[model samples]
Target: MSRSTYVQRTIRNTIVSEKSFKETLDSFLYELRFFHPVHADKMIEQAMEAKDPKVFDTLAEEASGRFGYLSFGDHKVHRYLNKFNPNRPVLESHAIALGTSPRAYSMTKHNQEATINFPLRITVTQRPNDDRASVTWDLPSSQIPNLHLNKTLANAAFFVDDKFEELIRFCSGTMDEKKYKKILSMDKGAKVGAWKDAGGPTLSKL
Candidate 1:
């Protein structure tokens, strides 16, 4: 075949392939809707007309937030929502600080039993698609905790939001090491002579 003819045929084949792929995706989405109902409805509608992967991602992200609140039974995502716009209203809360990386929680091996106090291993990863902390715990199906994991996740989100200001203040020259140490010692320590008076008897006993 001529060069022009070959190029034309290649373009035609590519178009046909894309059309076939789109058709298959449409059918799969049709079947998926039965299983997921609301999510599938939202995803399928977005997928069918979406020209970019970002659109589907947006739908998935929104659905994840909604499901997190509905299925998890609380507005966990709402607590830290202001972090995205820190200039806005501040929500004071506390959470485990894991630095720039999302917070993680896992069971550590201790005395031949699973220990929740200290994590055995920690690796940083991208933030979650939603406000839930990126923590993972060894929650066995047979031995699930009486408390919901989502509640803990929500608490973690709260901590991240609450401490952000303190962290920023420290970063932006609001709190330095010397001042912080002084504040800590002054707030927690006794007066100049309070310990000395008690120490008179304690020192004699020693």
Candidate 2:
């Protein structure tokens, strides 16, 4: 019964040419494979193997899974952020007990206290003759029945925004590789930091 609300923005031709841009985009997607639920490598492999028009949709479905949607092309990438389950332990144990997949279990109970998730998405694009690429951040809406539980999960959206902003800064050469690596290295709980008080306006809109 929970649904996601959508938010979006764009970054201009940051990369020089189409070829180089796609390569850079590929590298970025490659890095995302380190995270669970992304399945970036598998998506890429399948996309390449299919070599058909449906490849993009295949890639999107694989990358998004239950979280949301992610799609890539010669000049753009679209990400639809859904809630992320932090309690991997609980989800995994439940999966084992129920004889179901963890991913399936998480999808069913992503909003539960044992598995709170956030809503945030980013889109990157490059237009012809443009000197920069347009990057947009979208925070969707979702309902959490309990007020206390809602408050705890709300800050996660902004934290995700900050992390993506950091990634953009890294791509733009403003943030050094070492610092960016450190941010990427952080666990989910550590990433929330002091921003917990920032509140969940996006979630409230749900």
Candidate 3:
């Protein structure tokens, strides 16, 4: 079967059983593989170490901001994600779709064809309480003919519920200026922003 078909079938079988939660966790891990292996490895470590669901939720919040950490390739049907908390989320509601070009953004620099990795259409919504937001994920029918995916994936928000019990301490908050510069030199994309470029460093928003 095609990879797409396999993804569909795997999702179908997984979501319908007692292991639904576990399946959801696996689905995200599988999708992350399209990106950097380091990300997937780290995520798995987090999941395994998470003492409970609450810990996983915290990790997801942090991971969502570092999507760039995952090594994403040319194209793949990974996932559409939304984090619904009564407060600000790591990811607002958004749609992941197949496209010939990228979307306009300070990130993409309004250049469509420059990067075609995992392009998604993002729409930010604010509820009356103005704290909760819901993001929708769907393939624009006009873009793909008869797109069939487990619609459940759209609602499969917040896969893992807690943080991993085991954690790696490769990154630290303090460093000598020269040491920091050396680390930044490792990843040319290294940038200082909400999301650090490949090797650069950034602080988490509170």
Candidate 4:
């Protein structure tokens, strides 16, 4: 469903702390594995073995073309929710499509549960400095069921920005111990609505 409540944020000209351009690119691909395990895992492994960033770039290009079929487009919302509520019924039938152009990616998820479906897109571009990148995130509405369960799922889309920032900090080796531990704790288990509440700043700005 199309609506006006889209989220858009730009992290402007953030410097890449990695030692080299290859390392910077590799770090981005490596962090993506957490959100898109199936497609990114093999590429990550191959890149590690070959010590080549091009391997990851090639795989990323392929994923960008067939974005929907990639692991991220399928049941990713369900997977995220399952981490908090494993007993919920599995999402059996859903249609998620995603595609990416040179510097932008778009995705939409739709299914029986109204809360589980939404539209999100992101774009990251290298800045003139070559050692920095500009990132933008968008979520084109929040029309989900009013139930608590659905609210969490609906809010999950907004977490993409947080995840992206986390990835960048991690790659830069600037993530503090406290923040790292917090991420780990959330990954393990947190109260319902935790994500929604924690993501309020991002949503509020939207």
Please give the CA lDDT of all the candidate structures: 0.27, 0.35, 0.27, 0.40
Model 2 ranges off by over 4 Å: 1-20, 34-120, 140-149, 172-206
Stretch of 10 with least lDDT, candidate 3 = 160-169
Tell me the tens digit of each residue's lDDT in model 2 across 1-206: 89853322322223232233344344344333223453444555666788863574444434431212232222211211112434331110000000111222221243454233322233444444544444443322222333244443445433334444444454434455677566557654232122123334432110
Local lDDT at 91 for model 1: 31
Candidate 3 runs further than 4 Å off: 1-38, 66-206
Task: Give Cα distance to truth, residue 4, candidate 2, Å.
Answer: 12
Question: How far does residue 55 in candidate 3 sit from its true spot (Å)?
Answer: 2.8
TM-score of candidate 2 relative to the true fold: 0.34
lDDT of 3 at 60: 39
Candidate 1 on 108-188: residue-level lDDT in tens?
A: 111112233221111111132322112222112112232134344334333322332332222223345675345335422
Error of model 3, residue 35, in angstroms: 9.1
lDDT pick, better of 1 and 4: 4
Per-residue accuracy of model 4 over 1-206 as CA lDDT, tens digit each: 86653333423334435344345434444443325534555766887799987676566555532111123443234456567878875431222333222112111232234324322333333444655434333333333333234444444434434444444555454567776455445532221121123323343111
Top TM-score prediction, candidate number: 2
Off by over 4 Å in 4: 1-20, 34-124, 139-154, 158-161, 172-174, 177-206
lDDT of 3: 0.27
Least well predicted 10-residue stretch by lDDT in candidate 2: 91-100
Q: Give the C-alpha lDDT of model 2.
A: 0.35
